[model samples]
Target: MMEKADICHIVMYPSPGRGHLMSLVELAQSLLRRHPSLAITVLISSPPHLLPSIIPYLSSVSSATPSIAFRHLPPSPSPSLSSAPTAFSDDPAMYFEYARLNNPNLYHDLSELLSDSQPSQKPKALVVDFFYSVAAEVAAALRLPTYYFLPAGANPLAAFLYLPTLHKLTTSSFKDLDGNVDIPGVPPIPAKHMPSRMLDRSSRIYGHFLETSTRLAESAGLISNTFEALEPRALKAISEGLCVPDGRTPPVYCIGPLVAADDHISKHECLIWLDSQPSQSVLFMSFGSMGVFSSKQLREIAHALEKSGVRFLWVVRYPPPHDEMWRNLAIKPEDDPGIDEILPSGFTERTKDRGLVLKSWAPQVAVLSHDSVGGFLSHCGWNSVMEAVFAGVPMIVWPLYAEQKLNRAYLAWDLKLVLAVAESEGGFVTTDELAERVSELMLSEKGREVRGRAAEMRNEARQALSEGGSSRVAMAKLVDSFKKGMM
Candidate 1:
């Protein structure tokens, strides 16, 4: 697909984990797929580690492509807040530490990349990770165009970041903060629903989150991984108010839900499983890779799911120890049991027909996109929210930790498309509460309303990803920033 073009493209993302890399890879591939003539460069945090020989596919990426190139940049020898894992206690202090430790090196790396790169061609623009505000500064230093790459829809972004601004005006905090806090231009969000870390004055992570948010306010414009119908208000606000209130706020591009189902399989089996199930009869529960839960918690969840008698698809990662029966498989088979090994006995066999317990990774998108999926039990990660919205699956927001509470609030309170489970009475949810909410959300009248709304959103979201959709236009505008200097 290569054609003669003089522009060089430098794509930079955090190297802490695969999530950023995977997202960046997809975007890069999309650009390469769409514009073969364009020169592309990707700067990862570290060199690619050797892929497991047993699983062979990444070689397809490093080996097959000629025009596109991947380069690894060095991060701080010390890991930072962004790299730190969330503890089961749901604290955000660690998050601040990660960002602080990482950003210095992150900034240093971007500056170095800009200063040192000798592209056979000069970069036409600098595309950055939205979370990493330093990219814009780096581009500005060299007078290059910059674009903010947001991984979720604008609704939640506007909802979470503007909480303080809204709180100041409305004399109330939004949902998820704990109790109902009212905000300007937004519905009530609870204190419990607000990110647990945001309330922590002593949070090492919250401070870092605040720092990055400050940088986000100054980015050139937003290039979100969502389409218009998914977040109309957010897109409008971003377009008019310059999107960001505290910073140099730029335009917004909603070219997303950038979903690619064909990327991985052995996953399709899930779809076939759904095909055999009744419509809207199944519940999908998954806490993303990084979320941590105690072994007792895992066992409680296992017992709760079993007691509910609801059909479910649960993705079990390394689990916390529950009983001697669980000790045998305390962790994921690989990666040391660290903690994941405690599960109740007869988990798979007892729930065999009624449930499917998948270890490691399953294609989340494909599963959610299925028709039989009635409700989603989620951690409220931005990516999961996008998938749930796109798939029209209503959520049961678990929000295990981190910014998840805020994300959960957006879906449950602001959008009224999902139900939020509170953790205030106690820090964590027990199995009884988990099953109760699952039952309520998956079968009750309120659940029906949420499901209907979610389905409606799914339709609107799909259209946004189509030709000439608002999201498409927004994406085009962002890409055009490269072709024409920010005018």
Candidate 2:
């Protein structure tokens, strides 16, 4: 029994991709846990192929948490893939960007749904992913306050917020700026380590990034997927308006390290293998949903893993076109090619005793939570980083695309939670370098120190989420702000 005056309805729109969707869902769950009578409607802007995989999870969450609900936006009116960001058309992210550019459909459908709703069903505030920034105008038209939900760490948000200032100060592109050019709240990072999209002003994706950042700054508030203890300096800089000129940055609520629960524990064989291994003896490697490698890179990785002598569970997927096929249809083992087809000849046979080469996706959260797992070799996606921190696992950073390079810099150089596998000429990491780094992280005293730090961070993450903790207080403030129309 909570009072009717305490209830508030919040509409959440998550951009496409599993990481973004998962963060938003976890935030919704956390809100319901902390505040009674809070209702959430998650409006999804995912592709047709991706929806089937997510619907079951949404159904389970809805059944368990009565206050949370879901809705899918209708197809785009102009569903042409050619209208997508032209700079990186081959990248899988183009699909989401295409959906985002055509988000007038989401606005139209949401308006219709809200118009026909009862007074109780009306949303008090709208919360949206950074990609779906167009929803800010929709929220304004409906007289609802909007908050931008940044699924990445505060470092990326700070970078985005200050990018305009950096652009104005420099005569050339980001690629031409000094390697040590500093952004407020973040370490002085080289242009190579900054987000690649923001480097070239002529690129379509660059323009989109610029526009989204401006829109996010103009919103009522910001919700970041990071806890206060994890990023105190970055959070403080944003709140104090160090990045934005004129001290006009929005109020920030850091209620995160929001990770998925291990719901599919019984669904994978790797868990059984992990149960038999000694404590803290295994490594887990995964690139987030869109991470793919060429056949040459896969062979190099296989050789490196064999050379390291460390126990590992690696999730491998074929290069895209085939890699993306799972999104469109159910992935059957018989239908998809085996590891033998992709990896070097006899690679699996040689490593079968100490390694598990799982094709495509694995139950990541379940695998990370296993006692036998110690270190993660990852693409440095923010969700994966948070999950690793929560599980007390150190990392070897292997950034591939998007904002991952920045994440790698933050984790390995700034936060000291990870070791980076250095890339050779042409952005390809040498086999020897990969093997050496893996061995160091899985065996050396330096690795032990990093592991200890990770455990300490895990404790801090728990503390931030506990009762009377920083995240709990921030969440309370967020709810109050939305409810009172004070944002």
Candidate 3:
């Protein structure tokens, strides 16, 4: 007799950011590993990238697993959303305004597409992105088994997926200007601490994002790109929020920081350097893919790293400046988009013995797990935050871009799990400040205390991956649902 297949999985997500896209792809890979008999298909909004290397990694899922496949759906044609200049490329204030105007139809078109697709075997299950819960509405209409896949950090999703309700309780639930509010699950997430963009109610698009994500949180099961122990309170809240009519809550699993074996183009060099440094001595820094700093701020960061007098590893992947190009543009920093001259002069040489720098994709998990690495200086991206916590490293949070500033408060102040580095006068901090913060973390007693707690968190995080772990249990139940159609 021919071999039999167990389940058919269809995954849907829109890839506006690397973190979201990467998490969706990893979940597919993980499901493939655990249940090799499953046939998985991932549906994305587009089949392109700004950086060519991103194209490969995005497409890596297909290469890694022959049993898994991909399909692309176009965003319904629109005048502005159709290849427009984002604010960073032109004017930030205006671009976001445009995105806000386009939400209703954008949601409608995606929802319609999910509704129209017909599967031959009744799709063993539907796994959808947290941001596109409208797709879940379609899946529900079709009566297909469904699961929610959050493509960002679990803690953030746990908070955001509940934002509309949270907004109802606090006056600060809004669209403009940063405000702080207490997120009941975690510690107090201050209203002033909210990301500026998320506070605007006038923006239909922002509202849609929160509304859609919140719906996904209430699905039959919620899947996170994180482990349970990292943010137990948030995970529990998410579990309770998705309660079924029968007094049962949907399953929520945290299996993440989906460390890619290779980024599809380059090998990870950070791991090699980590081997050379002493235990907890190297401060690992990466501002996430979208991190941007003015020329002045860039210089200050270089200065700070140099002044710290601590061994470090940093990844710089910015595109070349308008006026300056990398000396070996066509190659050299091979995997990088092109950022050599964008870096400060003599900075690399000044810290040569103590620092190791890479221009492109480097092995992140390997570096975090290395003995030489101690603290992480991060941009507060959920994936990066999860990785640091899972690895048991304390963080020096320096949020530079995107909803990250909101996360900074959660990590540094609310959780008391990571140290928060203050932003400077010009909305950007200087290297002197960075160096000073480095000292506070490495040389001071307060730094030692935070590190001690972070180390303790590390053990707790690992326990979630152990046998009978919460995350493991969730994953098993999810897989079982696909076969039994309990979803």
Candidate 4:
């Protein structure tokens, strides 16, 4: 092993979006907190609209942790790769991926910046989100150690790592599989609970996913945003190389639940609304930053909220017109008048006393941390799930896209930390079903049982992060390995 350097730095390349950027930022901050002398840089390449929110959030964290800096790269131009899929022109799922595949600017910008760095300031390792398979190639060329940061639990990671095997074992997509697909060392997840992207073998994104998962094995290690107690079985499987052939797998580190702290949480109006509600009385609903629902669906949600009769705080966004694809766009905080037009007639006025509907972004961390929030009606994004667990709040899982369906399965069926909202006939969750689910999560005995489990998990999560705990020890070992040039 090489002698420890006087200064250690890691460059993080976050995929374009709120969730990816936020989780990576949290990981950087966590490293800085644990190792005060370390320096970090977050290389961002997101859509223009999200800059307002993301910039401020990063700024706040930077102010407190001066070792961390950010570099926002220009959004890449349209598909430049000759092999780029022409069919993905309007597919929202491929929005960022398309930008990344087409634009070569990210690699150039990163390389140039690193080349310009002083010898002492040059990063020893490059940390990148899972979407950044290209960064691994860059790191290998530069001979810098690379760690793949998976902003999800080990279960999802294990499932994804085994995609090739799953593809070989079945003739059809996992969604079309007759029964549960039993992943070694992980729970038997129903085929329908797999990610929508993985459900179709022919989709461009599916191919991309498989390639990325394979590329991940080339890295020095994996930094999972999960702890041991949370998914011991999955973590064990991953560490033992059950997800992939032994010696092909990288060293797996479980150092997570790396959720961000809301710095300006005190200023959000939702906190005031939450304060007035009694403990465990309000259900908070917020799809992730990119989550969307049709106008008709929004109306149904409003009616369901009205019928549920539970004190609620709903975070709403206006989706693009019914015919238009939902792009990665932000609804400005100042331009929320259209919500009134999109919501059902008289819904706001009727529920004024019992509900508060926040437009666009809310202090999600603060909202979940609040004593008044009992249950979360979430899109089951891993970050939101982590926050809810840390706050000891159970969830009403309503997965939207990406790995959310997989998360929903783990949370609802595997871990028993949430209640799932059943979709009605024709694949839409009706107002009646929504209302029943909200009521059950808020008022039923099952809700209490789930909440108890959530609280227990919350305690376990807190313990995992404390001194001498699993996360702390894992993170310590990771830092030591990096310093010793062993990772």
Candidate 5:
């Protein structure tokens, strides 16, 4: 064990969402595992609405890892929807604003942290989430080196770095564009298939994203939660400056497959159920944390699952209100309607023999790593995609929001490791389409091919993290750059 005076400290600031927070925490853990002489302090500025769900994970990390500390910044008020912004105050923009509002608190707390530390223990670098690029200004004000940590793959990083150029090339919203948007490294994405947040150019969220993407080049370096073998072309495009044509791109680091640590305390019921199934027999369906569907969509999915006849475990959250007025209400877990209320009548009884439907949450990392789990019906969030990839589980990509569609495009088209589920207008997946996709993913020859690719990538991911591997080498370079105070 290293003495306090011998340790190198680093500060990390993650954006508000659980996915963002979890990814950064995983990265911190990975760093400490490789460099025990390093101490990491994660500054969390959790939004009020998301605080409850984030607390348990925070507690768990704190208890499990003493070297990785967390300091909770004072909660900032949510951006008022009535305050002159367009009727498009989405969650992404709100999270950005929330983080921006905490800049003063961050500066004060960070200053004290640095001032109180021994000279050798002072933070060598400050890492901010991709969405929290604005915090880079605070880091700069403190004369600290800043790095942008993107808890995503290189494909999305390429698209984000290219946003400024894309903005200049088109005047209309992405949804209104006449043709495909050409992004470096990835396949030509249909304008409509762009991230939902980037669809409406006039929205404040799009403005935030554009500004964040533009400022990304100002960082000392970018550390992505991806490896070379997983996204070779995309990483190459970024390294070659194809993503940022107008500016000098910062050094890119490919070190990833970082996922949440599993707390092997007790066996979850879901895992026990998996134990009863055959190897590679169960299809695990889980949308991300904020993934919720309407009642109509729930029924359609129920119908699909029943028709597919595949053994499955599905985590279902309460359906959002149909009325826009009630959509923002904070629904408590205790208030969540019963499974019977949300699903089709008698759906649970019909599928009980071969399927298990969990309410709202499950041990996602453990489930994906289980042998009984074969295919994933996922929202294609970067973290979820990484988890599935690391587990070698094939997927049926059903993206919901954020950059998930972009992730879907990469997974389905570029990587060919997952099958894409087509959605009808209004983003509804019909029973037929969902059933067919599930069958194709679970039983078809194409599914077998995709599975093979996923397994190969999984091996590649393992190798990249092994001793003297590509990701390990990159990690060493990143640490060296920080130690040398290189910009």
Candidate 6:
């Protein structure tokens, strides 16, 4: 073991959700593997409802990596709201408020950790998830360098850094805009295709998002979970300072494809089923943790799947209540009802020979990496997208919420790695439309071409993580800058 005095220490603060935490943890693991003398302390601030889901993952990481430590900040009281938000579970305002309320605890915990460290082990930086940009002020008062880790690709980062400019240019909400909105790196985003939070400029969530976007420029550097080969154009635009027109863009480090480690012990039935299928014949469909559908939407999907005749493994979740008040809330895994109760009657029996419909959860990373899996019908969340990319699986982009619509735009229009599924008004996909996209992705010539591209990208992703690759070089540069105190 290395001497304590020779270690370089750092603090990482990720936002509340599982996706955000997983990204930062993977990043820490990567850093520790490269520089064994480095020490990391991850500060976790989980919402009360999400704590259970987070604990098991945290325990596993601690057991596997003793060099990395975890500290749970005492929960801050919930912010007083004027009214109950539409989707309380997935609300951005809740995340922002949690981060804001925990500022004092963050300062105390960080100061204590730093003061306790040996002289040579003073923390080189305090890295935070972009959602917690408000913490930069705390880092500043303590005289620590602050960096923002965006758990997303470069295209979303470009849009986020450019959001303040877009806000200034527009007089109305993005949803009401007459034409496409232009960010520096990516193609013009249709007004309706902008992130749901940005659609209403007057909402509290929009205000919080705009503030976070403005504050991102104050960081020492921005690190994204994407590689140079994956997003060449967007990365170039960011490097050239095109995204931030009025301010200096901080140095950007592209160190990723930071996927979660696959679970090797517990093999799911889905994996067993995939083993029996022909090579590259199964299409896997799963939404991210927050993704849910209405009963009507679920039925439509079942109809499409049964009619398509493709071998498949789908993870099904209970539909949200039709009650307007509860319609947007996420369905927890424990809350999932019987599969037969939600899907079309006899849907499971009809598709039994060709498909396996699992309830609520699956080992997503393992399934995507399986040899028999060819296509992914995904919600286009960045983490899910990266996992698919790493597995070399082409996708059918079906964006649900958060920045997913924007991600869909990038994956489909800019990268051409996935086929886009168009949604009708109020975000419903028809049976015919779903079936057609499924067939196109599984059997058509276009599917073959996209599959080839995804394969090429998978190789590039592996290469980027290897020695002498772009991501590895970027990782070295980040560590060097930290060591030299070059902000």
lDDT of 2 by residue, 1-487 (tens): 7655566878888876566777788889989887867888888776554566677778888888888878877645544543343222365446446556656776676676567546655677889888777777777777778999887898898999987787778667777666676878887788866887777777777777777788778888899878988887788788888989854898988888887766583657889989888888898999987788866788899999999999999999786544433444455435666678768888889988899888888888899999999889999989889888888899998988778888877788988889998896467887899999999998999999898999999999989889998888889999988776523
Residues 84-195, candidate 6: write the lDDT tens digits: 3333464777777778888999999988876863677567799998878899989988888898998888888999899998888868998888788788888788887888
Cα distance off (Å), candidate 2, residue 484: 1.5
What does each candidate score in C-alpha RMSD? 5.0, 3.9, 5.5, 4.5, 3.3, 3.0
Alpha carbon lDDT at 272, candidate 6: 89
User: How many backbone clashes are present in model 6?
Assistant: 0
List candidate 4 segments past 4 Å from native: 1-5, 46-53, 72-119, 263-266, 323-337
lDDT of candidate 2 vs native? 0.80
What lDDT is reached at residue 125 by model 5?
Answer: 90
Q: Which residue runs does candidate 2 get wrong by more than 4 Å?
A: 1-5, 81-104, 109-118, 265-267, 321-335
Better of 4 and 6 by TM-score: 6
Q: Mind giving the per-residue lDDT tens digits that candidate 3 earns over 1-487?
A: 2254434545455444455667777777776776676666665453233334346665666776886666555543454554553422343333333333434444444454445455423355667655455665555655656677765555666556656666566554453335445554655554545555565655654666666655654566777777665666776665675322223356676666455544324445567667777888988887776765554566677778877788888876664343234343444333454344666767777788999877644667667777888888888887788777777888898876556766776677767888877775446776667788898887789889999998888777667656777666666777777776424
Q: Which is the winner by lDDT between candidate 2 and candidate 5?
A: 5
lDDT of all predictions: 0.63, 0.80, 0.63, 0.77, 0.86, 0.85
Candidate 6 global CA lDDT score? 0.85
Q: After superposition, how far is residue 388 of candidate 4 from its true place, in Å?
A: 0.3
Between candidates 1 and 6, the one scoring higher on TM-score is: 6
TM-score, prediction 5: 0.93
- Candidate order, TM-score descending: 6, 5, 2, 4, 3, 1
Q: What is the TM-score of each candidate against the true structure?
A: 0.79, 0.91, 0.79, 0.88, 0.93, 0.94
Best by TM-score: 6
Candidate 4 clash pair list: none
